[model samples]
Target: MLRDRLLQMLPEDDAAAESVEGLALTVTDLAPGDLGSWLADRAGQELGLDVAGRALQGGGDAWAVAIADESGTSVALDLATIDDADLEALGAWLADPAAPIAVHDAKTASHALHGRGLTLAGVAVDTLLAAYLCHPDQRTYDLGDLTVRYLQRELPTGVDAESDGMLDLGLDGDHSGARTAAARAVAVRELAEPLRTDLASRGATALMAQVELPVLATLVGMERAGIAADVAYVEGLAGEFDAAVERAALGAYEAIGHEVNLGSPKQLQEVLFVELDMPKTRRTKTGWTTDADALADLFARTEHPFLGNLLAHREAIRLRQTVEGLLKSVAPDGRIHTTFQQTVAATGRLSSTDPNLQNIPIRTAEGYRIREGFVVGEGYEGLLTADYSQIEMRIMAHLSRDEGLIDAFRSGEDLHRYVGSRVFHVEPAEVTSAMRAKIKAMSYGLAYGLSAFGLSKQLGISAGEAKGLMDDYFDRFGGVRDYLTGVVDEARGEGWTSTILGRRRYLPDLTSDNRQRREMAERMALNAPIQGSAADVVKVAMIGVTGELERRGLASRLLLQVHDELVLEVAPGEREEVTDLVRTQMGAAAALEVPLDVSVGFGRSWRDAGH
Candidate 1:
């Protein structure tokens, strides 16, 4: 067993070298951070350790085993079986501030250790973090899977082990945890080096080490502080939405001149196309389209009462689902603890699960009512939401270096109004609301490579007019057109596109023979950089905001991050300071030609703060 473990840990060297080579290493009894971890063992280099096993195996606050870097088997300690005095004596030398440790889930183990009244000095190499930095596209980074992929080593299949999420050491098998811990430590030590080197090569070391790792602690705190949900309020909102749904369905029935299944798509299709004899929409697999977009188009064209009520019904149903979801996910503490996933999106955007907070709507009046349920918790002063203003457009201006766009931003005038004036050759103040709306649609639409037909459909303008408007807008912001075209051209040549932070997205479809696929890929290629860069800036802003809050020794806590917006739970007597800190940190997060503007508001609820 010892020989095999040595061979696995020290792949380059033979078992004979291990027999002669050992460390005069000292380790303190494992302090904090022992949920699960791995140590990188350097024979003659600075000392490190790897740990794994139950967080509290055998009712103790320690790992099953603690192994020093490459010499896992030769100098492995069974921490679970060891006496307290022996562990403490063993720890005396390991307590050297210079010795660093590596961990998989940094917070899980670190928080666990902190709970157990133990702590480790020096940095811990995070294997999970390292893997993410090396290749963000990989879906899962499970330890067992990564051990096989990276090290080509399978975990030992022990007796009756790995059942119901617990690995069973033989009934009296005391050394199983130690063995698993030692092996994991060895695997992590092996994987950490190459990942670090890869991150450094790509200039992502600072992003991973400085930005991501440190933010892990703050993220853990935010998850723990989960935005308090007013259960009764959410329940009431659900009831209201349900009642609205019934009213909408009844109105649809009245509009259609008879009772029908509003939920039945086929019935709606028959009524829309056969009974009503409306204009035929695009075909689908089942029949002519009855989807929301098609229905919306029908409503726009015919001012159909049925279509309007159906749309309202659908919205009410969706809002009701959101309210019910929030109520279902409320924890014992009266909060909704969403799991924020860092690596879900290709663009480095964080995604929320377990009742997604990001999907909440705010465009409608009732939507605001739902948001009101996410009120300030007991003992918290109020909620403060700070959001980036026109972030993506700002990014587009910066990326394209369009003088017109940048000047519009710098002018401190209304952006849509300014763009409208240029497009219409009118004075900024003379730009009518209709003109500004068209320009606003085009400005945002163009960034995503929106077609004239799509723009016409969205703005209810003729295709010719939409195309002419786009031409006029681009005529003024030629830099933007050129930049957008250049992004696709470069991606076609290179087979991938990258964000400002060097986060790359591969686009092989750019060279595909299929024109549809190629065009879609081009749009993706254009949007990825702008959207991804904006995402990167927000991530940086989050790190900075959290760090700044920590630096100022404030009691305010960040509760939720919804894309461009962050909702902070302000402590009493600290609202003003928190608001300033939030704006300063977010504004300074990224350096662009145009400034990153932050708009902050505070109120008793998210809705008020959001306004």
Candidate 2:
């Protein structure tokens, strides 16, 4: 009857018609007393689960779970009405590691369950992550979309078919929500094998199981145990930045001899190009451009006081906004819980949102001041930060197998200094700071596919000089040049690139007739493995660090992961041991031709630890 209902709900397409041909669908409501017996009978069996909730952050008070077992039998449980004993039993069943379970987004489900005083485990497959691994280029992997793409049928909308003038399975009352959740659970179950096979084909099965799945738990811990914030300090910083913004605006108006809206690009454009008779920037359909780079360049050429004040105003405004966001994000518990997104970046990188802590500046004075607001929690002795130094370059060395670069890393001298000495034909000690600076730019720039023009713009040198510098560096490091060229050729031949961990990033535009698109893909090809490998390395390190911390029964816990750095709260009397444990775990996260160098720091606040 349910199969027939599905058929009537979906459109009359051949694929949809065939989807329900041999399948049996069943839905049942198990009373609270029946839950224990049902879970016992389903022990060691694979199950598909779906959670209905308002959001993942707090797992709204009214949340239920739909589960599908092996016999195509689906059941829905309303946790709100379940007794304490039944809820505890259900939590134990969900947390049983021996039981295999499949879910669309295990992280979300886990977070929701966590919010409801439960824990989710035994997640054999996360269909959402699997879909991402299979099709890394897709922007979204929504369940309904994946169901249509894989199962060839539209997911059920959970309305009583008879009431909605569609096929109904002799059902009535407020059973729609349970029925819809059960349908989704079944969809997730059906999608598991297909997505698993796709991941196997892409050679990312281990990446999913070993790195992504395990890291899901670690991320939930970090999000729930969000770093503590100094509320008074943050509010003070916000007020200070607001005053600074006003001052900068006043300076801008004073320079122009008139009060104009500093935030208005049109007004600024009129003041810059027309009233002041300054050279116009690149023209757009509306008017001349007034972007940050254009304004900076204009200031460089003319040294205009107004441009200076305007740039200062923008910077102050941005800092003020960032501080204000942090202030607003402080939860009632005095911490900022950022949401970590795993599938957003194609390169296997993790991104954070809802007051993104990762995008916080780390190089500016104001940035340092802002970080000072993230203080160690009350019970924590201090904060510890461990960062990888020149990790990308080291990865490049391993990938390229360039003896010159490898030897430089192994020689125990500064990387840029050693390369500078070789490029300038001087001893390492004789390499001047300016020479090392140029070499540093060129070395890191090559990994990013930086062209001569781009390098010149970055270093403020002539294009010819930049070109000559690159050529000279390549001549000294022939293996690096050959490896860079060969990576593109190999990716073009294979139609994808693989990181050190064998994570593939498919690039179909490699063969495009459009030169711009093809060249852009080529740049991506060059950078993908390097950046992606770095990401993989960090993920592995996070897993290892957390695993070791748990195994050793340490009280210290991981707080945040931003790029190549990991921040942790040091437990009282555990600082030295935790510091050593982190260094050992992170340093050995990946093995390559070059050693992974980790730098460790500690203090009362994130800023002090980082510095």
Candidate 3:
């Protein structure tokens, strides 16, 4: 209205009015290179305002720029839609070092702009990152949502903005776009302090500043330098798995004396109980259980060939599915670019999707073969797989302050073997294989709130025997048993559990009257702090390793993080330094009663690296 009214005050041939530009800038997404550098220089100064193409879209998805300091906002342009000359003009204005650029999430936008050859410098704060610090649990930290959430102000957005108490400009129109962008840029700048202050209030400033932010930079590099996949090898593995699937299917049919769908539960039920007249294992909602565990139990009792074939069939088909999934997700560059979802898991663990590199099986021989397909890329020397050895156990020992458990780790003997000896009343060197296996299972399982009954089922032993083993084990390591029980009790009393780093997981159901609900929450409460602390330690280690690599100017790239492991692609001649750095950084991620032990392996393929 102001511009139109002023235009009406001038004569039709008024020279000044004729040349004046209406929202004199084209709005576009932030792209890297010369234009990106230009925009980076202009962040945070009063500028001619128009549209904020980047701000309106979302920081991680786009870029923001200031026109002229009419309050550090201008017409934002989508680099995609704007004419070349208009873009160049916008670039020229942004080249001024005085203009300020604000982004929503530096992980997405900064890394993207870096890919385009423009590294963001100067006054920049990712408000999305700010919102994360404020409320780490909220997954989507979009601009419009955060503005309304933090500032009680809604930016102009959505398909129909006129319906809400927002700027009533059409979403597609330049005027509306400019309003949305301006509102967001201002919000990004304005929202930072309140969020930061909130972080300070919660005592989360160090977690955000020292841990998450630096780790995010590492994650960006990992996401971009995705692990290379051997396409031909993957295809060949799929073929082998296909043949195995067929053979397993044929064997099941022959063993049953007739063809049946091994994948179908109903068909398996008919063949197992009705046709073969086998004894029932367990009852389910539909019928007698033909589930994997139940079938395995039945096979153990009767040595049923059909059951064995069925299990084999299931395993083969699963391998094929994994291979097919990988083949489908392979990008044009021959790498599997798994998107690491940083904020998905409540325990602060990272999740991988679009091939889910984390879930790739590693227990079976075929699984090891599947890993062989993860090979080094052209520019990297080889892959390095480094992992913390029994990190969670060390954390358990530290948190429990259990003398015997600490001795087991500090003694430098085989941990499980030594533990088995104590429970079996034998010397560490005299621990039998079976005793060590059960001890190992109990050692890891107890930390996760595993009960005697559950452990019995897992080990295929009588529940009474399992109970005796647990009782004996706890007698030897009484501190661990006491600590496990105390964690649940504390959570029930306080309504939450805190990790060693002070991250909290609130377990509201710990106070519930319902026994089932209460028990589940108890297990979670008991498990959360230990697991969450390990997660914190790994994240800190990631940041340290990444920062040190950059500081030392090494060419090796951290590719994937699989729970307790870090997979790096080493460059030529940097393997020794990189390996030592990873071990040191990971080991120093946290201070525990016992040492943080790390195991490092490297080879041409992920399989070899594991060895």
The 10-residue segment of model 3 with minimum total lDDT is: 49-58
Winner of 1 and 2 under TM-score:
2
Report the C-alpha lDDT of model 3 over 1-611, residue by residue, as the tens digit. 32343234335653322322322133333222434443445545533322232221123234333233233333444444445555555545433444454455555543544433444433234566556656655778777787788878665443233233123232342344344444445566666667778777767677776777667768768877888999999999999999999999898888877898777888888888989999987888998888778888888988978889898889999999999999988776788777776666767778888769998889998877999999999988999999999988999999999999999999998999989999999998889899999999999998788999999988989999999999999899999989999999998888778788777677888988999998988888888888889999999999888888989999998999998999999999999999999999999999899999999999999999995
Q: Which candidate tops TM-score?
A: 2
Rate residue 441 of model 3 by lDDT: 94
Q: What's the lDDT for residue 378 in model 3? A: 92
Local lDDT at 125 for model 3 = 40
Looking at candidate 1, the ten consecutive residues that score lowest on lDDT are 23-32
Please say which candidate is ahead in lDDT: 2 or 3. Answer: 2
- Where model 1 places Cα greater than 4 Å from the true spot, the runs are 1-68, 73-99, 107-125, 155-171, 174-185, 250-267, 274-278, 299-308
RMSD of 1: 5.9
TM-score of 1: 0.82
Candidate 3 is scored at a TM of 0.82
Best by lDDT: 2
Q: Write the per-residue lDDT of candidate 1 for residues 294-366, one digit (tens) a residue.
A: 9988999999899999999999998988898899888877888787776567667778988798888898887
Query: TM-score for each prediction?
Result: 0.82, 0.92, 0.82
**Cα lDDT tens digits for candidate 2, 1-611:** 33344334444543422432222222233334465666678888788887666334443444567677765656655655556766787789888877789998787778667766888877899988888889988979988899999989888764443233222222443445555666778888888989999999888999999999999889989988899999999899999999989999998888889998988989988899899999989898989998889999999999989999998888889999999999889888899988899988988889999989998877778867999999999998999999999999999999999999999999989999999998888999999989999999999999989999999998999999999999889989999999998999999999999998888899999999999999999999999999999999999999999999999999999989987999999999999999999999999999999999999999999999985
Error in Å for residue 224 of model 3: 0.6
Score each candidate by Cα lDDT.
0.73, 0.84, 0.73
